[model samples]
Target chain A: MSSRYSWGADEHLVVQITEDMSLESNFKAMAMASDLASQQVDGLTDICPANASLLVRFDPDRIAPAEVERIVREAEGRLEGGGPQVLETRIFELPVWYNDPYTNETGARFRDRHQTPDKTDLEFAAQENNLPSVEAFIEAHSGAPWITSMVGFVAGLPFLFQMVPQERQLEVPKYVRPRTDTPKQTIGYGGCFTAIYSVRGAGGYQMFGLTPVPIFDPTQELPDFTDFMFFFRPGDIVKFRRIDEAEYNQIKEQVEAGEYRIRQRPVTFDLAEYEKDPDAYNARLLEVLYGN
Target chain B: MAIEVIEPGLATSIQDEGRPGYYNVGVPPSGALDLYSAAAANALVGNPSSAAVIESAYMGPKLRFTEPAVVAVTGADIPVLVNGQSAPSWTSLDLKAGDELSFEILAGGARIYIAVSGGIDVPLVLGSRSLYALGAFGGFQGRALQAGDVLPVGVGSGRPGLSVPEALRPQFAKEMDVRIVLGLYDYRLTDEGMSALVDRPWQLSPVADRIGFRYAGNPLQWKEREQPFGAGSDPSNITDAGYPVGSIQVPGGIEPIILHRDAVSGGGYAQVGTVISADMDVVAQSAPGTMAMFVPVTLDQALEARAEARARRAEMMAALS
Candidate 1:
């Protein structure tokens, strides 16, 4: 419950929920951001909830900086009652082609910056986490669902945290030096979070796979992005389904023809219910997504 | 009527005040880097501050007007030209049909704001005409102007001869002290590192752009401690967090990058400090090779600077009116 409130220059007020990253911290940050947004405070431009912090951007001309701090403090106080953090969100089945050639080529090109130069990113990550093989790592990665803790570092990119206990969470360090290039739609990993690169650009995360479906379509040509260009949103749940290269190509063709539709379903995510037994809660959520 | 692009300069894009409220979804506030200069240009052309304008970096574009218009240029110390004849900047100039507009070599500053009487008419995406090139959604065709691109101009009742006084205009400098309000993970830096941030002058690197302005300087030192769980092993790394516009992050503690208007919303690097709001325009004016000395100030001082900047804008508006 320890939080540090600091100024991000004169325009932004950043509230650090905790020094460490955890699901609870992220929930608190997201809750606070949601609460602040509902208030419609004047001068408040953006309310960004990150891994373990909440950043509020405002205009000093419309409202005083001290007033912003006071309002945020009041919002933080409301969360002290331990209200049920229930979010009615959507669950998406994102197909990931693990150890794909695209990412494999990218990983090979940047081996000089990797911790294990001789091994692929998937193999190195599997070894680092004590998994028997890359196959085992894929199961561990795709076994459970992940929550979109934050969406940033570029347009439409979503940072995901696995829905598992702390001890079971897979941890991996980023590249020794960030590669100058990372293929768009690449599923990369760093620290305890996995990210889907919405667009091709410079990245520090370890390349593990690539997704055929577009998470970010600026043209909004895809059906999933009909209403918005970004396919993922904060609080959305994602289940990564491992697919072969053949399936990836099939989906890619469908996507190019604008006939592809992402598998998704609306569901309620309750923090209290999840805390009791994450595995059971996830099971029920999956049933809701796939149950006919 | 429309303006035809004869030559696309270094990086010319349509920009306005910016798009806000969508940062939570990773959409940056893509807008004019130097808001003050853009506003001044708009004011000269009798356009509202929110009207879309052309923001050219390093070099200016050569444009041909299909019809009569009133235009003004501001921001960089570049000379405006009308059919090869030198025209005064900061003053609205009348352009006849088929009149060609261009610019001389940039003497100072890195960007120029060109505001036409009728703002560049473009469809508003997410409530903005500003371009977020990385996202490729807003502005003209969701990208920078290319050769032979015909840009539609909105209708207006703007008059020529309006001008911003020389005394009120911003002055560019080779060596400038950029004010910063240090906080947000600044505690991760050692005392010596903090001292070095403000004591030494950092040169602007070539990597400077809309996303961020990178500075070359001595490596900063981080406080010794075990890397926290979920945080990377790099001494300069922190748990991924939100980055405010103008936030300064030194990745690997080597180069400090000041995230600008088009910056990513969040990242893993520790943001040691944020440039004060009043000085972001100053940072925008800096070109490659400019020397910037980071100066830390208290919150109260930062607010005072913001108030002063607001007053200056008011004065300029009153004069133009």
Candidate 2:
């Protein structure tokens, strides 16, 4: 696929792989970012890979912008063969309380900006996707594992895309006008991606649920965040396990006591094998995650 | 030694050259918005350019020295007062124990930089003392200075009479022609919209802060087309992507916001252009109600401006030495 390269001022060089989001574009961008990081080009400050683009921030004084562009071009050329098909990553089980009170209250406050002001965010989302009920929508959402296409917008927030085929993907538009406040850990959906709000701040995405686990711990008070403050990273696989309010409160207590540990396992994801028989492959992956 | 905050002003926080290498993880390089002035303040106090300095917004903080120390104030056209006596800005001034440092009303500019001989001794978080207050991680207790807060000062042997040449000092302007390198999403805008962006003068909105500077002007129109899949329905919305520091994004084709030192790393709004690195300091100096016109330049021209800025900074440092 053709990519467009443009300058983001004197310091940042942006490479747009596609105008639309697709697993192909995401993988390509991620591969290029990984390759550039390994090359360790001098003056390179940040190499960020998004859903369909990569932004390279550099110190123009140490290395010319042209030189940085040349290195990126070379890396792109090297990946013409489609780069790596498999990623050695971790699958995390994230417990989410759908139709929770926190996000529901937040959604109510911002309903004036929503497309369906009379309906809750989950109900509107379900209606838009032609799902029979919100339960069916939740099932479709939580049933499939999703890959983290990017991590940003705020500290530790992850943008996730379902592993299912494009035809089966859940799609919903963002709010007509953005809200000035969003409760931290709100499970927000926009277009084809799902995002977990790592912090309480302004947001436009439709709130669907609230996760009890903290994806970001600035204090590093939690056991999972001992090594790093951010829990999500690009290329992580997330399986949202639906939970009730009781479980949510229970998990919150465990988290407050610093006893909660996220359920995760290391696994190698082979794209080619998954493409052959997605359902069978996903079943195997889920087995690997939950099996003793 | 420590400096006690008598009054915290509008918002005062510790800043330095900033923490780099963390942008990919959504952490912005939170630092002094105007690096040139911040560095000049440091030079006047015989501190390294990267040393942590106090950054005050709109209003200057009221500080009392706990011991004898050298200090300097730079950025903004504000009157500096030491123990209720007028002091020259952009020059080192000696303060004895119990000497109070304060400021008069701001004459121009939006931010001020205060540098002590020994840098503000806040414990560094992630390799820098700059405060990312939104994330609450870096600088003093991961927040802005509050009244009665005792800030520790590092030890330094700085001369008390050093001064920066007048020519090297920054001049805050009520109107500015901000240079930008357009692209990264300029294709999304129509030719008329592009022209309007450069032709119109936008007034800086009062919402300006460390996160971003918003400008109020006539809304630009977008070219009609089928919305790309997974991109939001709004004409200005693109799939969420990383936002470069100084990038300008106009949501709903209104009120373009230029992300600053404490910028959010990525978002759904389409950024049509980015302010050239050299002009970021100029943008930082602009106070509310400042009229700014966007001036687009080629990559080569942008680089030339960067070089000129670097040379000028070097000259300032040389003069201080």
Candidate 3:
């Protein structure tokens, strides 16, 4: 496969593996990024892997632009011919409160910015997908596992793509106008990607629910976030499990008490197998996460 | 060994070379916007190039020194005042205990850097003293300096009379040509749009801040194509991707925004070009309403420019040594 990449000024490089959003494209990007990280090239300051592209930041003084480009191109060539690389990844089960009161109140405050001002974001999204009701939409969303394609837009905010086939994938447009305020942990959906707002700020995504767990902690107070302040990394899979407000409050208490250990299991993600049979692959991933 | 803020002018905060290596998790490398000036000030004050300094935008702070210390001011063309007396910029100066320091009204440029001997002894977050105010995590209390805020200063190894020559300093101008390497998603733009990007004169908008520099220019047009799956209806929106700092993105294909040191690592906007590293300091110095036209350069030219910039910093450090 011919991989396309470009120079981002003298200090950065952007390698685009594909034009559209797909699990294969993301997997390739992750593999390339992971491979680059292992090289430990001097002056390679940061490596950010997105849905279908990889951005590498380097110090021009320490490493020449031409040399860095050569290294990246070489890595891409090896990965292209090396066949599929199975990466050691983790699967996380996140507790979400669908159509929660907090998100509902937030949606009401930003009604003027939504396509359907009279309806909540969950309502509009459910109706847009031809679902019978909000409950049906919630069931569909929670039923399939989603893969974390990228982590950005703030710290630890994961951009998740549903693992189901294209036909079954739910899509929604961003807000007609961006909202100045969005509650932290507000599970938002836009352009076929779901993200939990890591920190409250300006956002355009349509809010559907709220997550009780914290994805980002600057203090690094959480036990799971000991090594890094952020919990989620690219290529990690997450299953958004719907829960009641009571459960949300219970998790909140545990989090406040500093006893909340995020439910996750280490697993290997085989992109080749996942692409062949997504439903079966996802079920196995779920079983690994829940041991059922 | 401290300075007390009598008045925290516009946006004063502690900054260094910025915190790198965190963009993967959406954390931007928040550091001094005009790195050249910041490093020059640090050199003048006998500190390492990465030492933390005070970065003030528009207006400057009024601080009273608690002890005798050496200081240097760089960036912008504004006048620096020491105890009601005007002082020369780009030169090291001695501040007696209880001596007050302030700045005159805005003359030109957007920001100014003040480096004290040793460096601002703020606790480092992620190995940087630079402030990411949006996250409230680093710098002096992770926010802009406030009135009565007392900042601890490192011991002074710098001596007065160490000055940077006028010939070595960057010229602050009302209009300039900022060089960029146009690529990364530039294919999304139309031929006409690509031409307009380099030809048009863009005025820096007043809304420009540390996060990004927004320019008011001719609306760029995009190629007509069926909206790709996962891409939004807007012509400028792409499937969310990583944004290199200094990369230019035209949202709605109208105003082009250049991401800066305090920008989000990635987003959904379609990027067309990245302002070269050397010109980023020039971009930071450009004040609101300044006219800036983008000039396209090859990778070799960008590298040459960066080499020249590194030479200047090395020269400054040698002079101080």
TM per model? 0.98, 0.98, 0.98
Docking class of predicted structure 3: high
Write down the lDDT of every candidate, Cα atoms only. 0.92, 0.92, 0.90
| B100: Cα error in model 2, Å | 0.7
Show where candidate 1 strays beyond 4 Å.
Answer: none
- What docking grade does candidate 2 earn? high
True contacts kept of each: 0.89, 0.81, 0.85
Q: Which residue pairs does candidate 3 place in steric collision? A: none
Expressed as tens digits, the lDDT of each residue in A204-261 for candidate 2 is: 8899899999999988879998888999988899999999999999999999999999
Q: Tell me the tens digit of each residue's lDDT in model 3 across A119-238.
A: 989899999999999999999989998888999877778899999888898999999999999999889999999998888888999888888899888888888888887888999989
Chain B TM-score, candidate 1?
0.99
Alpha carbon deviation, residue A271, candidate 1 (Å): 2.2
Residue B186 error for model 1, in Å? 0.7
lDDT, candidate 1, at A8: 87
